[model samples]
Structure formats: structure tokens, C-alpha cells
Target: MNTQDAAIPSLDSDLADGAITPIDRPTLHSVVVSRLRDMIIEGVLLPGTRINEGQLGQQLGVSRTPLREALKVLAMEGLVELVPGRGAMVCVLTAKDVRDMLEVLSSLEHLAGTLTCQNASDAQIGAVRTLHDEMLAFYRSGDRLQYFKKNQQIHSALIVLAGNASLAMVHDILQSKMRRIRYLGDQNDDTWSGAVADHEEMIAALEARDGPRLSAALVDHLTRTWDRVKDAI
Candidate 1:
């Protein structure tokens, strides 16, 4: 066998050892979008990086059609900007951009707090608690990526529980816009710990179903987010 072939682990051996498992693959567009998003968030493709479609398509083993489609989706989410001549560029946030979005997001979440405390079923609240537990588990295991995803999910779940489609939609856009900065900000151990403490307070207030208290906590969390992530931008 050639050296490349020799290095390949045998599928039969993996199957025999129960090390192989079947998994459903995501759609082409979804996979491309996810990979591109990760690359941007991890700084593999830094902010203001102009996307070279042809080269990127080759690297991703995809065609221009799917790549373009994925870029369109990302643009809508505010993670990438579509330029007239430049194709696509990763979105760059100034400190001012971060501040503006976080301010708006804080107000939205503050509103969501009252609505959620009033409208959410016990089951809905419990679902967020479950996500919090899972997030904490990921944090304990030092799985930062999974923890970050779960953390976002918990916030989104609260917005969802508010039972307002508009709030959820806007929150999603803002969350996507800030994803990379938030991930980078938490790189500090002290900042990450403070964030966890903030979440603990949030969940506690939520479980108590105290509208004012929950709103206070949500506002505090979102407002303090600026401090946690300001240096990252």
C-alpha cells in the first residue's frame, strides 16, 4: 500500500471494535455555513478578511453556488457583510458597534424577562434549567465550544419563552453579531467565572418567577457583557 493508504485506519477494524457509528450528515449549505462561521469565530478568518470565493470553495471541497448561498445566509445573520465588489468580508465590530448592540440587547432581554416570567409554562422554565445544567457540565469538562453554544441556547430559550416571535428574531440577529467577540472575551478565566456567576443569578431569578427580579438580573448580565468583551473587539 502507498504511504497515504497505509496511514488510513481500517473501517472494518473500527466496526469490529465498535469504534464506528453511523451519523446523519448535515446538508451541503449547512455544513459550509457552519465551517465558515467557525473559521470566523476562531479567528482563522479574521475580521475584515475579504473572502476569495474561488479559493475558499476549493478548500472547502464545494462549488461556488453552495458557498455563495452560505455566504448569503451568514450575511443575513450579520456575521458577514456582502460588498459590491469585494464579494464577502467577515464583519468587523468596533467598540462602538459592540456597545450599541449590547445596549439594545439588554433592553430586549429586560423586556423578555417580564414577558417570560408572566407567560412561560413551568415546563418551559425547566427546559432552560436543563440547558443550564448541561452548560455547567460542559464548563466543568473544559469543553469551551459546547459550553458557549449551550450558553447561547439558554439565553435564546428565555427569549423563546417570552412567546414573542419578534423578540426572538431580533435577539438571534444580535446574538450572531456578537458571537465571536463573546467567545473571545471568555478566554479569560476570571471573566468566564464571573459570567457563570451571572448565569447562576439569572436562573435563580427565573425559577422564582419574579418578573422584576428577573428583569434586573437580565439587564445586569447584558450590561456587564460590555465589560467582559470590550477588550476583545
Candidate 2:
């Protein structure tokens, strides 16, 4: 077996061991989509790299049908590009694409900050604070991947707090596109410190329920983040 294929856990074995339950069809599709999305975002599958359907299917321990379906979903999300006669490749973002996406993301986060401050329950805000603390711990420990994941969770929580389903859906799509670039931005020590400071301001604004301040902070944060990552993109 190939290295990638060998690395995959057997689904049947996992199921038999009660490690993974037999999910419904739709849920299984979602799982496949999530796995492929993560693989791309984490750089396991590099940008512009052509996808090998057979090898990937073996690596993921999924059949060809579900893998193809998952690739379609990823294509719709702009994480994969389907080229005629060339099959699918991971999407490569141009500098302009990054700029455009960050602009939209900044606006969305601004709205999220405004609505979250106005609408989020005390419990929800507290939960976000807890997550922020956990993220900080990851940062302090120098666990970049874990820190990035928790950072993502905090942003997602803010969207959830905004209580707008449409906003949440749009934000998720854009966020997926920017994940890898943002992760790379944090690799610089100065930029990473600045991001942590920005998060601190975000938490403070949330705690004070200052909608306008939080909105401004979110916009400024995203702008500076783009500044840090633009050259790399």
C-alpha cells in the first residue's frame, strides 16, 4: 500500500470498535467534505496541486463516489477548481483574491461584532471568553496549529452570537478560503503578537458590550492582518 493509504484508519474497524458510529448518508458526506477541506487548509494538499482521485480516496478510506461528491462541494466553496480534462486541483488564490476576500471578511466581522454586542446572551459571551483563554494558552505554549484552530472557533462563536443564519453561512465560506493564508500570517513573531493583542481588544470590547468599538476593532484587526499576510500571498 502507498504511504497515504497506509496512514488512513479503517472505517469498518473504527466502526466495529465504537470509535465512529455509522452516520447517515448526509452526515457522512459532510464528514468527507470536512476532511478534505481540512487537508487543503492545513497544506497537506498544497495550492494548485492536482488531486489524485484514486490515491486520495484510498488515503481517506472513502469510496470514489463520496470523494467525488466531496470534491464538488469543495469546488462550490472555492477551495477546489475543476479543470476540463485535467480533473480537480486545489485552488490557488491570487493577491487580488486575498485582498477581495479580506475586505468582505472585514465587513462581515464588523457586522458580527455589532450584532454580537447587541444580541449575545451573557452565557454565550462567557463561553467565548473561555475559548479566548484556551486559545491564549495554546499561543503561550507555542502550539501554532492549536492556537489557530481556537482562534477560528472564537471567530465562529462571534458569528453564532450575531444570530444571523445568512451571515453565518457567508462568513463560513469566506473563512474557509482564507484559513491557510491567515495561518501563515501568524508564523511571524511580530505579526502573531499583534494578532494576540487584537484578540485581547476584541475580548474587552465584547465584555463591555461596546458595539461600535468592537466593530471598529474587528475592521482594524482584519485590515492589519491583511497587511501582514499580503506580501506572503
Pick the TM-score winner. 1
lDDT of 1 by residue, 1-233 (tens): 99999999999999999899879788998999999988887788899999999999999999999999999999998899999977999999999999999888998999999999999999989999999999999988888778888999999999989999999999999999998988886687888888888999999999999988988998888777888887777
lDDT of each: 0.90, 0.91
- Candidate 1's displacement at residue 40, Å, is 1.5
Q: Model 2 over residues 1-233: C-alpha lDDT tens digits?
A: 99999999998988889998655566778999988987887789999999999999998898999999999999988889999999999999999999998999998988999999999999999999999999999989998888998999999899889999999999999987788888878987899999999999999999999999999988998999888888877
Off by over 4 Å in 2: 1-32
Please give the range of 10 consecutive residues that has the lowest summed lDDT in model 1: 182-191
RMSD of each: 9.6, 10.5
Q: What is the lDDT of candidate 1?
A: 0.90
Clashes of each: 0, 0
List where candidate 1 sits over 4 angstroms from the true fold: 1-25
